[model samples]
Target: MAKLTLPPLPYGYAALEPWIDEPTMRVHHDKHHQAYLDNLLKAITGTEFENVPPEKLLAGLGQIPEKIRAAVRNHGGGYVNHNLFWETMAPQAGGAPAGELAKAVGKEFGSFDAFKEKFAAAAAGQFGSGWAWLVVTRAGALAVYSLPNQDNPVTGGDTAILGLDVWEHAYYLKYQNRRAEYIGNWWNVVNWTKVGELYGRARK
Candidate 1:
């Protein structure tokens, strides 16, 4: 049976330090993310989805066996969300994107700063444990939205090019209820290059 595995961080735990903190990264990846992956694995094991890719399984939730569909949606969504979360950030990678990605953002949101304002608002305004995302709509346009819990945009035929986890566990240890502060600081670690790459692929 094929199984989903956790991918190692591209950089050390401390790579995004001073902004995200080392201890948070350690616990987030080792415990939280691992639990999601494990639960996702358990949810699909021995089922027809056992060999299906994460993206396919998530994008086709309606087809999942009814008994384990919820479990698969929550855990599998977490697994994929965390994977993109980690990949879209890096040690010293925060900066504006260039080229086609930049053009798209500018065209969609008027300006990069405008886009940041909208994205940040979405991330901070997400009511509870959920995620805010910059996704490629089915129509191939950029859009910002927030989804509650582990609901991924893929389920709606959208591609998430960038995402921010607003779940308290993602920042409470360090931000201590200051989600706005955490959200602001998170921009420093965003890997625009990676996001641009995802955007380029999603458009195709």
Candidate 2:
């Protein structure tokens, strides 16, 4: 509500190329994510919501004024979702988690490969525009699920350890209609370091 600004990409648009491509990152980060921030600022400008953090606003969305609830939900969620999406990947990242994260995933999903299979399936099977997540559930274990549109597991008391934007805008330019290919390649860019840190935070 305090004039959310688009987060600058920590890496160049072309850094994640070969898998994500330059044009898609440009539009996704600069144009699309920016639009969500701009619209969210306008939506909360004169309301009681002004000054609330977008993540806090979303975590407590049920308390928002009904008239502007939908705007805040869509745009605010877009803002939070996109920011996390960017943080979840890096230029040369890949392989898998280490330390406690590896232990957690292995304990919960049998093994890291099994976890990848489930997570990738979630990303591939999601219909239409949505996000797939690996989240720390309320029960203190990892879980995988996909949600429609910009919705995330946070509102339901889970912490998103990883998320993928399965919306066409995320990979349409490079993958065309091949979302499975996109999902498979996406693992190569996984910033498991960041994800493991988030997993630690979420566990506490």
Candidate 3:
């Protein structure tokens, strides 16, 4: 069986300090994310789901074997979410989108600050244990939504440009119960370059 493996962080552990401490990234990536990958790999053994790319599996979760479906949802979602989360951020990154992406944000949300306020509200307001997503809806519009547990928007026919994990585990150690503060500081590392790339792909 083909197994999924944890990918190395693009930057060193200490790369995203202060706003997102080295300790949090270390534990979140090393322990939590790895555990999900390990479990997902084990769950797919001897199943036809083995060797299929995770995005494909997640985008078509209905077709997976029922026996291992739950494991695939939780662990596979974790695996995919963490990968995107890491890529969506950078050490010295942050600020609003530029060029075409900036224009789209203006069209969709009126202005960059308006978009931030709305996105921050979604991130801070998510009930509990979920993610805040900026997705390209099938209608070619940008939309914001939240999902519980490890559920992803791809399964609902949307492409996520960016996502923010609001689960306590993502912010507890550093921000404590201040999910609002975490959401605020998260903008400091919002890799708009990558987000623009994702936006271009979503439009296709």
Candidate 4:
């Protein structure tokens, strides 16, 4: 596989502050995300799968050799998941989506408020470390769901347009045990414009 480097955050560590803290972004992106990429590189180096593109790896997991599949699944998913996590957030963002994405949300969940309620519920109700997602299912319908560990929707033939990292590492420093508050505040930093782009791409 071509070497996959960590993508830099679009904004400074402090950009999303007051919603997501500076210290957490620093640790989450620099420490946690970097570790996942490092482990993924180790797992794929010198293997047949080494030449596969990073974007194709997760969807092709079944074809990966058994010895390194678990590493690829966990670490690779973590690496890709965090990439989207960072890209889909920005400073001073938040508010309902517009245009096509807005129509889809309304059509699928009744209204944006209802969608937020369902999405937040999925995020807060996730039993342990996991992610909550707004994904395009195989049939090309919008859906909300959560996955365990570092699992990705791609593995199940769904395309995640928006995702929330509910892992303690993502919010514990600022919100402590209040995951609900973290989930609620997370919307304030959500890059809905980017999410709309992803939704369009997924629909295509």
In model 2, the worst 10-residue window by lDDT is 1-10
Assess each prediction's global lDDT (C-alpha) against the native: 0.93, 0.90, 0.89, 0.92
Tens-digit lDDT track of model 1 for 151-179 = 99999999999999999999988999999
- Tens-digit per-residue lDDT, 1-204, candidate 4: 347899999999999989999999999999999999999999998877777865588998898888999999999999999999999999989998999999999999999999999999999999999999999998889999999989999998899888999989999999999999999999999999999999899988
Which rank order by lDDT, best down to worst?
1, 4, 2, 3
Q: Assess the local accuracy of residue 64 in candidate 4 as a C-alpha lDDT between 0 and 100.
A: 83
Model 2 agreement with the true structure over 75-133: per-residue lDDT tens digits = 88899999999998999999989999999999999999999999889888898999999
TM-score against native, each model? 0.98, 0.97, 0.96, 0.97
Model 3 residue pairs with clashes: none
Ranking by TM-score: 1, 4, 2, 3
Better of 1 and 2 by lDDT: 1
Better of 1 and 4 by lDDT: 1
What lDDT tens digits, residue by residue, belong to model 3 across residues 1-204? 336789999898888778898889999999999998999889986777788988788899899888888988888999999998999999899988998889999999999999999999888888979899999999989988788888888889898899999999999999999999999999998899999999999999
Model 3's TM-score against the true structure = 0.96
Point out the higher-scoring one by lDDT: 2 or 4: 4
**Model 1 spans > 4 angstroms off:** none
Predicted model with the maximum lDDT: 1
Name the runs in model 3 displaced over 4 angstroms.
Answer: none
